[model samples]
Target: SDQRTAWLPAFLAYYNARRPHSALGYQPPASRIPGNNLLQLNS
Candidate 1:
């Protein structure tokens, strides 16, 4: 359980920062954040 807890943050980071969502036009949730570099790179 400790190992799972340790990796959970990494997994959540990837999910919220990298995983694309169809509802978001295939962009990661992080891209919607103000001044996120990811939006500039994608554009």
Candidate 2:
């Protein structure tokens, strides 16, 4: 049960920061967020 607790944050991060959505022209929401470390994400 404890392991499942981690999924929400992971999923949100992926959904908002990694996985691109067609609505945003296939760009991740994070790209629109100013000052995020893009290099760290690439790694």
Candidate 3:
């Protein structure tokens, strides 16, 4: 939905700076969003 998409950047910021991803070994989006690591996908 638009609600989730609209805040993508916001979530990305958090995902990169605050959220700890298990697949990312507790890393954030900054290191898990772009490049070859496409598993951490979003809409």
Candidate 4:
């Protein structure tokens, strides 16, 4: 459980920041946020 707790936040971060969603036209959720420099770097 401690290990799961430690990794859960990391997994959620990746899910919202890097994983593409079909409903979002295959773009990560972070890409939709304004001024997200990571999006520009990825593109």
Candidate 5:
């Protein structure tokens, strides 16, 4: 759906920023982050 497509990035941003994942050992996306990639995003 077009509406869902538009909202996808936003959803991913939050998912990769704040959402915790059981696959990553019950850690928030931030904790599971590997390095400075996320840091670079904010800059």
Candidate 6:
């Protein structure tokens, strides 16, 4: 429980901001959300 609480924020940020998903055309879910910010991935 302690570990989960400690790591949850970091994990959620990664999951929402960095981790790419196939269902999203191999892009991170965050990129799809309406926002001015952009993330660039180097191939």
lDDT of each: 0.88, 0.83, 0.76, 0.88, 0.79, 0.85
After superposing candidate 6, which stretches have Cα over 4 Å from the reference? 36-43
- Model 2, residue 26: what's the lDDT? 99
Order the numbered candidates by TM-score, best leading. 6, 4, 1, 2, 5, 3
Better of 1 and 4 by lDDT: 4
Question: Weakest 10 consecutive residues, lDDT, candidate 6?
Answer: 34-43
Best by TM-score: 6
Residue 11 lDDT (model 3): 75
lDDT of 3 by residue, 1-43 (tens): 9999999998777867788888878887566457775665863
Better of 2 and 3 by TM-score: 2
Better of 3 and 4 by lDDT: 4
The best-first sequence of candidates by lDDT reads 4, 1, 6, 2, 5, 3
Task: Indicate the TM-score of model 4.
Answer: 0.68
Query: Which parts of model 3 have CA positions greater than 4 angstroms off?
Result: 1-8, 32-43
For 1-43, candidate 4 gives per-residue lDDT tens digits of 9999999999999999999999999999887877646566568
> For model 1, what is the alpha-carbon lDDT of residue 36?
38
Residues 1-43, candidate 1: write the lDDT tens digits.
9999999999999999999999999999887877635466567
Please identify model 5 stretches exceeding 4 Å from their true place.
34-43
Clashing residue pairs in candidate 5 are: none
TM-scores for all candidates: the values are 0.68, 0.63, 0.38, 0.68, 0.51, 0.76
Q: To one decimal, what is the Cα RMSD in angstroms of model 4 from the true structure?
A: 6.2
RMSD of 3: 6.2
Q: Which candidate would rank higher by TM-score, 3 or 6?
A: 6
1-43 in candidate 5: lDDT tens per residue? 9999999999998888778789988677777555757576566
lDDT of model 3, residue 15: 61
